[model samples]
Target: MKNDTVGRLKMGYLPLAFVFLFFATELSSQVNIADPFVLRVDGKFYLYGTDDKKPNDGIPVLVSDDMVNWSGPAGNAAGKLALAKGSSYGTRGFWAPFVVQNNHMFYMYYTANEKIAVATSDSPLGPFMQQEFRPLNDSLKEIDPHVFIDDDGRKYIYFVRLINGNRTFAAELADDMRSLKPGTVVECINQSQPWEIISGNKWPVTEAPAILKHQGKYYLFYTANDFRSPAYNVGYAVSASPLGPFVKYKENPLIRQTDKIKGTGGCEFVTGPGEKLYMFYHAHADEQSPTPRRTLFSNAIFVPGKAAGESIFQVSENKVFLKSSAR
Candidate 1:
């Protein structure tokens, strides 16, 4: 009878142990990756963004097997490439680069001196070669280039143009992804909105525009206020078309710094395995001295029923404990 009881107890404990092990694996899979840009190409994932250090002069790249733990700065595979001859702009350090692969060729869109440029590479970890120095509206001082390929085999580049005294504008790229198509500039939003407009500030500012298409509508996400100021925050606007007539979300400034946390801005969104949405950005370290030395943080973005749903860009509770896990 005692042997029978022991057998039953062992079976119960076996299932319990399995459950614990499964959760442990799932928890281990959740890693803290900063400035989180996730790109999946040919069955592999690549992440690119700014490192925690300020005035970061180099582009940092990370690769992951399962979109969890990342492997590197990809071992010196990226840097500035010479601008093509006769291209008169964008000859400087690379910053805030976003990479995409199409037709087995890799393209990197990056910002320098508030101008956006394009480079191409045969490999994802690239010694990318510069193809053009100025790829957007030559008249506009633009930055934070985000490229999207729509379902109709059409390509578009979405970026923020600081114009008309420091307001943000959005424009579309030509199909070739090399330059802005004529008459494609659409003034999506300006600092005129009561929430965007600030008192005693001569410059109305908005920048870092990222676009995602969801359920027949396009969502435009951006940041506003002076990045160096305490008021830095993230906001969103929506449109039925890629180039819009964007409607600012009633709840503008979706995420901002509170008394507890300081210096919150620079937003990018990525969808990971299991269709999970993640927001990647940099913030000031709460415990570290001299807050300018910010660190990267990631948190799950919750959206429901539509692609333009609300987002919360806060550091995950577990992320606070995650030491810099980069290898």
Candidate 2:
């Protein structure tokens, strides 16, 4: 059903209604987390997710400023544990953890027993130091590990492979942001639409990938089904470059599942202070249905018109309004 967003912003922009995410409450139970990953060092904003693996294979760090008050990743709160515990591929099963920063260092990309790794830190609150423990490609089944760096600076590395199931891949990274730059990998999107099937036609699904470039194109956001169904939301694809042939957005699932947040797909997109653009996700915190505990949300992503890089984005309307109040 190739999205319309009000007939493609009425042919050139002028439709703004939906704009959500202002969570601090609802589904309470002190918001346990899931697949979220965000980082913005100095101006302060660091959140990593999917923790609670019995006392410490570690991976839970929270600290927000106005992304609507997000403290408490557990116990002594103020949220800590930015990727600890040793690894040569063995230390529990930390699922997703993605961080990026260039020259001044700070480069963490995670996932353990299912492969995909990289760690190094100068700060972003980390004891992170896996120093190339290997697995960018060792046969498939990789994990979600995003890292996009473009605008003429080139450094891409979006992941998620599983042969015939969860597919989303990209390459081009070498400048020591930890290898990969041999043939430019590339295999962008998979899992054909129809609301991303679920049990038939090329089933399986996509994974969490987050790329955003605007104007010059290259928006790849992902997240399809079975992220504990409720139809795990979010979908996007478009590319002029950034290792792609991408093109899935006939008005696709650019974020869905609501009626009190039963699905919001693991997401990440950043930018702040005068640049704005925000989107951090995690929500399965059922108010009356699907539940498994996943709570950490945010919104605000715009691109209304006025031209610059060729405007056409509004995928930040999950609920579009929900005040703040959970702690």
Candidate 3:
């Protein structure tokens, strides 16, 4: 009788131990992607970012149903890629992917081999590839391509040009969506503010440009400082037009590092349940050592200036931590 009781006790404990181990793995597993951008289509969210673990895979994508629990692409346990390497223009260095839908096709604007390029796919979970394997323009080395289409249907591409230490620039994209329009290139924002300077030096580094149009004004959201710096943060500039004579907000560094997290930047906005705005970004995995392999984070944005008829965006210090468990 005592042996029977012991066997039953051991079986009950086995299930309990398995449950605990599963949740612990879920809570501790990091996404391991940098420069995350979330795109919501038909109530399902697809995440694309710089693939730190498999750079040769081109762009890696993760999927989520409720924005809290994320899984590998296509319900796979692991190893799924949206843009495969050698299938596109870039041989390596694919970073900062931004996607947009036009005419029933999805276009992915991203950095490859330190140059801005665009690839297209029928679906957002894309094997996005280029018609001809080439960078957008070969005149200069650029990264971080953000394509914005205005209300009147004019398209503009905002990117980081390596002219004077990673300065941000904007130009009209040609109708083909593969090249820039002639004579439309304009410098959007330069790193002149003190917070934008890196390591007490006047190093101009403003990249990861995201444009949000609200109340008929263009708000350009960008990251400042070297991305590896603990001081790397997010700020915004307001302009009347897409190609902007943009004015930096008086209160800059909108999304900054906290006591626990460092290298907090790479801001991308998306609307969640009931139209609540959320900003997705990444931070250094280790506080002491900043590297390319960062962890993803998101937070709710409170925009009081929008109620006042202005272009202002604010993210709370409290973040929404995403788990890598079953959705």
What is candidate 2's CA lDDT for residue 245?
Answer: 94
Q: Which ten residues in a row have the lowest lDDT in candidate 3?
A: 1-10
Tens digit of lDDT per residue, candidate 2, span 1-327?
011111222222212322222333443335455677767667777777665343247566666664445565421212346666663343667777787877887777877777787877677776666654566666666888888776567678888887878888989889777779898887898888788777654558788887776546677889888776777888888788877798887767766555777667877765533445556677665765545446544444545545454455565444422222233
Q: Which residue pairs collide, candidate 3? A: none
- What ranking emerges by lDDT with the best candidate at the front? 3, 2, 1
TM-score of 2: 0.31
**Candidate 1 overall lDDT versus native:** 0.55
lDDT, candidates in the order shown: 0.55, 0.65, 0.74
Candidate 3's residue-wise lDDT over 1-327, tens digit each? 010111111111112332344355564556767888888889998888887766656887778876656787542212457888877788888899988888888888888889888889888888788778888887789998887777777888889999768889999988887888999999988888888887655557998988777656787889989987888888889888889899999889887567768888777766655445567888887867766555554444434464465635566555554556434
Which parts of model 3 have CA positions greater than 4 angstroms off? 1-28, 75-79, 200-203, 300-311, 325-327
RMSD to the hidden true structure, all candidates: 11.0, 18.6, 12.0
Shift in Å, residue 41, candidate 2? 35
lDDT of 3 at 263: 82
What is the Å distance of residue 69 in model 2 from its true position? Answer: 19
